[model samples]
Target: MVRGKTQIKRIENSTSRQVTFSKRRKGLLKKAFELSVLCDAEVALIVFSPSGKLFEFSSSSATSTTERYRKCIKNLRPSKQMDDSQHFEEEVAILRKKIELLEETKRKFLGDGLDSSSIDELEQIEHQLEKSLRIIRSRKILLFCERINQLKEEGKILRKKNAELREKYEERQLELSIGQQFSSLEQVKEVETQLFIGLPNR
Candidate 1:
């Protein structure tokens, strides 16, 4: 009896799987041979069993056929530029992942999380953090210096106002003292004149 049509997925039963493998392998080889013979064309087929047994078929000497295959592969190889572009894309992806990981580790080191990480990766992240810290410290120092300079300018203005007030106070004090002296002298003169004018004995 003919077997039912089988699906292309892996067969679960061990015996059935092996039997299917053998049947398909033979059928494929048979078709390849028929095609080669009908077309009068060179053909080569290689099959390997799941158990590591090798099988080979070639219309010509295996060596010559293999050489021809190698030549064809050489002629059809992808261009160097294409290979370089593909490699560049892979490297860029790797670098982007590294940057993302470093950023995540930076957050962890700054008390963000307790993610599992390697010591080496942590060290790299630490170095990156150190660099960022230095930059932040430098900026902070610059801002502080600017603030200090502004305060100094303000202090200079306050000092100038203080000196001006002191000078104005000194001038006011001198004017008050001179006016009191003149008034006291005038009073003394007036009393002497009155005493002389009213004196019985001089």
Candidate 2:
């Protein structure tokens, strides 16, 4: 029968857990030693047990190997920092060049630096200016049209008001004329009555 794979988990029993720790620790140390001897490599291993026991292995003096590892890491940090600094400098240079190009383009747009521009560049600028002018003119025309429409509406309102005022004035005049005619007829009747008050002159 094929043997079943053992499930790896924490051993709850103190004795069993200690036994497992001891076996694994020995096996790990043995592998470290073999790897160092077979590959002629510098190897270091360290382990701390649950009981605060220490186990360690090294192909050479442990303190020396640790020092070497620290020095190697320290050396690698400077190299990486230098690479990063160089990259930063390169980025700064690229940005500076871009800013200069943009400033030059701005000067050209403002018609300040045309002596250095080629024929094609001049033509491009000319085209851009023409397009800008066209846009400006179109906007101007639109504003004029809106203003004209606004004035037309205002004029129509004024004309309507004037017509209303004229109608009111005509009605007032007609009322005044009718009142004067009635007053005149009353005066004429009073004069004739006074003249025939006593007797006729014949």
Query: Residue by residue across 100-172, what tens digits does model 1's lDDT show?
Result: 9888766877857656767886787688789999999999999999999999999999999999999999999
Q: Give the residue spans of candidate 1 off by over 4 A.
A: 1-116, 193-202
Worst 10 residues of 1 by lDDT: 191-200
lDDT of 1 at 68: 95
TM-score versus the correct structure, for each prediction: 0.43, 0.50
Task: Write model 2 residue lDDT over 149-168, tens digit each, in one string.
Answer: 99999999999999999999
Candidate 1 clashing pairs, residues 3+ apart or interchain: none
Candidate with best lDDT: 2
Reference-based lDDT, residue 177, model 1: 100
Deviation (Å) of 40 in candidate 1: 67
